[model samples]
Target: MPSEIAPAGLRERKKEETRRLLLEGAAHLFKERGFEGTTVADIAAYANVSVRTFFRYFESKEALLLPDGVEIFAYVEHALSERPADEAPLDAVCNALLAAAKPFSASTLTALSHPLEDIENVITARLVQAFSDFEERLTVLVQRRLPPDTPDADLKAAVIACAALSAVRAVLRTRRARRASGISDTGPAPLLRAFGILHEIGSPERP
Candidate 1:
């Protein structure tokens, strides 16, 4: 029994270690050779794992790039659950967006550091797949906040996703602009502004 338990424990630890190595390896290769130039074989080699093992962890390259979408959905769900039942869905979403911005912002910057032009073709392909997964996760979260008899729930969810994604992208763009312009603000003002704009646009009064 002890031997059995030991192997299970060791296997779990090894799985986690393998995942960490894969992510680190991908980041390095993405920066060095660009996302498009790197292959699953390259990632597997960098992680010192078999190509078969890579598939076990990630179905495709896009999965490696945006691994935290599920985790972010969980965070959004938790945030929404904590709000009072009477709170407006839009407000709850806005609050959730604010809560989520920190981690997502950090990850976006890290992902962008990977050479883009060279990797654009491959990254775009992966992103199309990844964004589909992301939309599904987001729809589930939005549906939970809407009324049971809500008309056009799917449409509303799509709009919400669009709004939220736009806000995040706009924030990143503003940050980049400021950095390029040599603005000295180190604060998260750009993200806060993005959230505020999204909140206003998503509010019921906007219609």
Candidate 2:
């Protein structure tokens, strides 16, 4: 469990729960049959929900493949805004990301353990189109914490954000792969370590 999970309003929590079910069900189907072979109706049935319910959660069958799409990252942006003023910006962003990831359940991990090649191909394309500004947002957050005189702050910020995001993606991918192999170490220690390393890389000495 994460040391700190962000608080969500009741209605938001309920909606997230629904979206979670849809994602888990869709992932299970995608793993068994592959993305090209799954249908909206199939996912809904697997999740024990009506097609209307599925539509309420996702715009299309393809959309089901990317439950962590723009809207989720946008929520993460909101989380980023809420971090305490005293916290390092890199730490804030990493904590915000960890908070977002902390809610994933066992079943969700099972869904994600599916071979990422096909799923990654689809979701990566969609992410590039949908959350194009995500990288920029992260850069701004990171640069805000750098010393005012730091050379190439903008470029450094971009690198930090990209590295952190890429590392996070690796963490989840590796965790899921572990779950598939019957390893149940689903704690936040690995998350903390990844961000801790990212922070070390992003932060510089004050001299």
Candidate 3:
């Protein structure tokens, strides 16, 4: 049994190492040739794997470049659920978004350091699509937090989730713009500011 388990574990590790090599190779080629310019063959050759092996791991070059949205979404959902029960609705969502953002930024999306302009555009478009997915899932999670008997509960959840997700998109867009302009600022400050604005919108009194 131990011998059988050892071989399986080694095989899994080798598969994971191959996947990582492909991602790292893709990142390097993307930086050198831009997203549109890079090809699957180029990545496979760089990783010293056959093109067929690359396909066994990733469906396309874009798949190699994009972060795993399902994994990130799960992370956000778990983080939101684990927040203190007494925490404010907005604050809970904010914390979850921030927690997810750190790993998101550290993923393949930013591994290129500074992706070319075209590559950045592709990433920005993909993220915008992901925002919609996050909003849909978050609405359900936010709804769970509200009293079941609350009036317009579904609408309230949808609005809150949408607003919170827009903040995530806002932060990404702002950072991308700043990076394009050669102004480097990578932190949670932008996200915090976006949520602060949301808080003011729901304030009881307007100045």
Identify the candidate with maximal lDDT: 3
Report the error of model 2 at residue 24, Å: 4.8
Ordered by lDDT, highest first, the candidates read: 3, 2, 1
Each candidate's clash count? 0, 0, 0
> What TM-score against the true fold does each predicted structure earn?
0.64, 0.65, 0.72
Roughly what TM-score does model 1 have, to 2 decimal places? 0.64
Better of 1 and 3 by lDDT: 3
- 62-149 per-residue lDDT for model 3 (tens digits): 7654546667788889999999887877788889877876776532334332333345478656655666777888999998888779
Error of 1 at 76 (Å): 2.4
- TM value for model 2: 0.65
Model 2: lDDT to the true structure: 0.70
Give the lDDT of residue 28 in candidate 1: 83
Which of 2 and 3 is the better model by lDDT?
3
Question: What is the C-alpha local distance difference test score of candidate 3?
Answer: 0.76
Q: Which 10-residue window of candidate 1 scores lowest in summed lDDT?
A: 109-118
State model 1's lDDT.
Answer: 0.69
Q: Give the candidates in order of TM-score, highest first.
A: 3, 2, 1
**Candidate 3: TM-score?**
0.72
Cα lDDT tens digits, model 2, 20-41, are: 7777887778778877788889
